[model samples]
Target chain A: MTADDGFDETLFELALRMGDNALILGQRVSAWCGHAPVLEEDIAMANVGLDLIGQTKLWLGLAGEIEGKGRSADDLAFLRADRAFRNCLLVEQPNVDYAHTLMRQYLFDAWHLPMLTALKQSAEPRVAEIAEKSAKEAAYHLERSSDLVIRLGDGSVESHERMQAALNALWPFTGEFVAPDDVDKAAASRGLGPDLSAIAERYNETTAAVLRDATLSAPADAPVRKGGKEGLHSEHLGYLLSEMQWLQRSHPGAQW
Target chain B: MTAAGTLPSEKDIWRWLEDVPDPEIPVVSVVDLGIVRDVAVDKGGAVVTVTPTYSGCPATAVIAMEIETALRKKGLDPVRLETRLSPAWTTDWISDEGRSKLKEYGIAPPVQGTSCAGAMKQANATVACPRCGSENTEEISRFGSTPCKASWRCRDCLEPFDHFKSF
Candidate 1:
């Protein structure tokens, strides 16, 4: 494909994948806005969620820009139907317990930090710029989430059990993150993305260390699910999109 | 309006902006916050490009308005403000002079370093205590009065201070 063929389809698809992850994770985290176990934690989670939403806006906006469509970030986020989103199933999972939330964050942050670090050197300047800015925020989120996992994993018997369960439950979804697709291969070859296979190694080391410090055992190897990077998502995405798009679909360009 | 060859210069416009303090941190001017990335004149009017300290920072709107107000007061009727997020705002963009001014005004400036360092390194970085000029300060909380700052307390002065976290 020629560079002038408009926005690179592969790049646009990659941007959507990145944007979807942020959007779905932001939605899941936002659910804890008023229900956090502690006030400080409530605010912290909400703040982190807001930061992710801001990131989603930027990435999604770039996606729209690449597509050369008239759609704005808001339109893409709230108007898109299910099966169109490219986010991993892990992000779309419901926020069941505080332990679940922390586990999800820890798992995702471990991968995100390295991914952004690599993207900072992307051939595309805009992608590199966004990655540079976002890497800093992701680092902080990873630190806080890692600390939480350790605390809960080593806490009272009941808390330790709960966190361990959370870790085990979410482990199955972790494989989907590093399962590369053709789009990912294309971007990686161009120096615009990370080699997920390599990232998986770093992710394993970091996550294992955190788990060990928390007195939790890492889950054994499991068959990984695939296709999220290609617009194939889990059942949860349909419900999420339905709720998120209700207002936008009903109103159709209605602005506040 | 001044005659074609007799108009005031860019320095005059910058001097006029001296009174425009940052909305969130009143001690420092918008220019000092490093938000004012560029200032130039176009055919229509004066154009100023600003990068917010963070995305969704509430102070952004107020800063834009203040810039417009300040320019209008200086007889620049047509002032345009643009916000850019591409390069992303870093606390390193803040000038050393601005850091000193923040200290003098009772606000701790952001510490210098790359964000890849873990939280422990971030917390241990020397942030001069706003009150007693002590280096024996500890971060009390990562989240502070606003999204941009962290609360710290000095071992010597025993007073809590807000350290603007580097974005």
Candidate 2:
């Protein structure tokens, strides 16, 4: 509990942002249910999605509790509008192909590892609890994606080119993870969140190592894209929200 | 007070829980699987602390309901199942009994001391076959029939088996 009410809201909002990333990405992964390249991969990826959605429940569950609005995790996940979402744009982007999916996963896993590791020391016990729990899963996910990236990038002509292209297109989105903003400032000043600067360095270094192993070159530095946290997102997020929320909206209060 | 028998002791409740088999693996009990982390009889009621095998295993709800059903069947009033996920559930928590049961039931038990992330780098990590007891085995797939197990086949016996993933 902070003395400042505004700070508390920012903290809660931060949780929402974090949860949105997991939920949206998980949803995207789930869409690959029967369509993954292979049967084993289908199961593995869906399991990964399931883990993320489970984590989403924990984060949004806590956020709902903190907000004290009588809303449940499902309420927060299903009822929220596109403009209200605060996930990083990378997560909400369409899964163009396996290459893009793996690339985006690898990138986020890089950030997720350090950010969650640092968050294990959060002032809020609940935040720390979720962080501690999430870090293990995050590590394994990174391992899988990291291994895949290497295999795909170094595998064959077709795979290598596809992976390289995916990396090139997605690298810019990694910037928003550590870029400081209002929520970052509030969380950092109060020791409620990770020190983003240190995590930023680790994330970049980790990504570089993985890319090197994959024999892929980092994309040339360019203007970094931003603003999913502030609720301004690309056109992709709207369509994603429409599909995700369609059932909830069409059949209000529907429960299995 | 509602005409059921007297409440069982915490120890007795734990013993009672041993009869409730896991919904997925019917050969092993939930307590043996380590999902029922703690059981207590407090002034308020009986509180059973649980940690699920994996975060997303659909079996969690079924296991919780089975726990409550068993408790109610025994007349334990106001039962509470609290999910504690901090330390997280790992294969190491599977009781010795659970491991043996898994093997006898045609599943290779998880290799302890290796975390799931540790196996991630080496996805096809070798394991002994439950049927042939041969160490020369290869993972058929990283994912098995269930979320917790990996499909493996023994080279020597040429028989397929399931290895409980340690994640």
Candidate 3:
């Protein structure tokens, strides 16, 4: 197929990455809908989840539109198999504890802020538009997560230990965020994506500062896992997709 | 008591809606916020579809009421307002003309690249003062009175202004 007729698999992959991140994270957040550490935090987490779900819908819808397929956002999100998902391993990880969730959010938000900033200047107007809008919400998510991390890290001996442990556990997965893949390079060449390497540096600095403020040390770097962008995900993704897609698969085209 | 020539069309309903200012901004109308997504008319009544700027935005209820009220006052008593959340709302939906109007209303419009990372940079970057049109401005706080705004102070004019959050 000529370049014009040829599908841009790279762009499609990038969109899937974004959509999966939002969808998975949103699902995790929604788990705390009626059960938060506090009432205010409960509402706050729910609001954040709502924002993420909204973002997921937009990204998935765009993905469908770009693919020129008849698949709707629901089809892309709730009808796909686990191996077909492109979400990061970090997002798919379970929300073990409040500290764990906060740590994961802090790390993800730290990386996402810079990545979205770069994406706002994307050559693709749709991607840029979504990035521009999402960046604002991500800023709030980062701030709130930062505040929680600092509080937990400095609160009590147990709290501090838990927060530190969470940080250590999550550190390895972070390496995947900055490591550029074929999709990243392709989008960067077309100005439709951000330079992940530059974003990585900024992410490291910002996250390091936050950890330092919380009296927590950064975890040592470890081997990074790849393949999420290639539709290869962790074992946890199968369970997630099964749950998310069960209703859609069971009752085809069912609507509330 | 109809004081007009004929019944308003869907487009006319939207045009008349121009007079309904946003309850919060007052200066900017709902149309400018991109909240008024679509307007349609049928034999039963007119349907005005609006998507909330934010999911938890308290202004949505008021805006819906305002739309119904405004239409009713124009003798469209059976006006129906619907809310849609599927596509989601984005600040990019705000038009250039709308941004200018927001600026003129003394509310510092959200900058072009208003993402979280960009906003953090904005906290340190030089922002034009809404009052004096100077580039000397400092962020007072990231969280403003509402979730949708940020507080800033201009050094030249020494006046505090609200910058609409870019989201």
Candidate 4:
């Protein structure tokens, strides 16, 4: 299913993986619309979701072209089954509360900004172009999430405890950020993208500094959870995909 | 009309595009926003290359349709709209006239050079109030009503306004 006629399958997987992360997380974030703690937060969350969904289109559009399939961004986003998704486990986790949502966003942005920055120099011209554009938005996202993580994590005792708990719960899935298998290694070796492991140090440093400021501790000796990168997602992803794909499934090609 | 078979000059085509106001900010034309990167007239038709202001801006489609509709009404049939991403769109590209129009419309124009990494680092850049001309404006939120803007309020005037994001 991953093979492509003219394009490298590794590149297609890379693009699909990137697109799926953005699409799933965007959908998750958008779910917070009208449900955030305050009006400003509600708008802010929706805006961030819009940006991610926008990036998803670029990534998925590139994926479709690489696959040489008639599929489009919409097809890949709304038609794919849960098992077919290539996003890491981190993004598919449930948004249990405001703290969990922010923590997830912060973790993702910390990795996303650096990843896109590295991908800006991708050997693939298209990848580089998309990365260049995406990195800017990612930077903005990271800046916002980092600030919030610090504010809420260090704010009140209740807020601090919630943030700490959220961090502890979410940290395990982060192991997937660096668990690059054969596909990632091949992409990195070919200069199509950066090595995931190489990006790990940077992600750790960035998140560490922000966590320190937030008065949160990284869970030491946390079990490393992997496999989402390999299309083995947590059960939460099935629920997310079911709801996200419902409209598309009910009325295929439904549009205004 | 120049002639039945003759095509309009690129400059003339640009002028026609200026008539296409941005669907979100109708005060400024797409050309004024500097999104209409290049206009090329060929035997086929006029191809207007546009760069999106934001990755997920919903106005992108509307703007494309508006451009096509405006051009087609001018008898320029088969207008091809192309999306360009390189050298990504920035508020710095907002023409001087566009900046002025934004202020006149009660929107704060982005500070020059804020699109770069240096300025992005400073999350709370002081923006002069569009309504009161007070530099005592505070950012209410980074994300605003539109993708390309941020919400801000003037301390002096107490009037909330949208600031076109540095991006």
| Best first by lDDT, ranked | 4, 2, 1, 3
lDDT by residue (tens digit), candidate 3, B33-135: 7888899775535789987786445677788998889888877767888866535566767768778988888878877655434454666646577789997
TM-score of 3: 0.71
lDDT of 1 by residue, B30-81 (tens): 8777778788866536888988665546677789999998887666758998
Clashing pairs for model 4 are none
lDDT of 4 at A68: 82
Candidate with best lDDT: 4
Which segments of model 4 are wrong by more than 4 Å? A1-7, B1-6, B118-125
lDDT of 4 by residue, B1-167 (tens): 34575668998999988889999999999999999999988674778999998899999999999998888887776789999999888888999999999999999998877886548457656789999899897888988888888899999979999999887
Q: Name the lDDT of candidate 4.
A: 0.90
**TM-score of B chain for each model?**
0.87, 0.90, 0.85, 0.92
Please state the error at residue A150 of candidate 4 in Å.
Answer: 0.7
Estimate how well candidate 2 is docked, as a DockQ score.
0.60
- The Cα local distance difference test for each model comes to 0.81, 0.86, 0.79, 0.90
Q: Please write out the lDDT profile of model 3 over residues A50-74, one tens digit for every residue.
A: 7788778778887887787788878
Docking class of 2: medium
* Candidate RMSDs in order: 2.9, 2.3, 7.7, 1.8
The true-structure Cα RMSD of candidate 2 reads 2.3
Residue range with the least summed lDDT across 10 consecutive positions in model 3 chain B = B113-122
The DockQ assigned to candidate 1 is 0.43
**Better TM-score candidate (1, 4):** 4
Candidates sorted by DockQ, best first: 4, 2, 1, 3
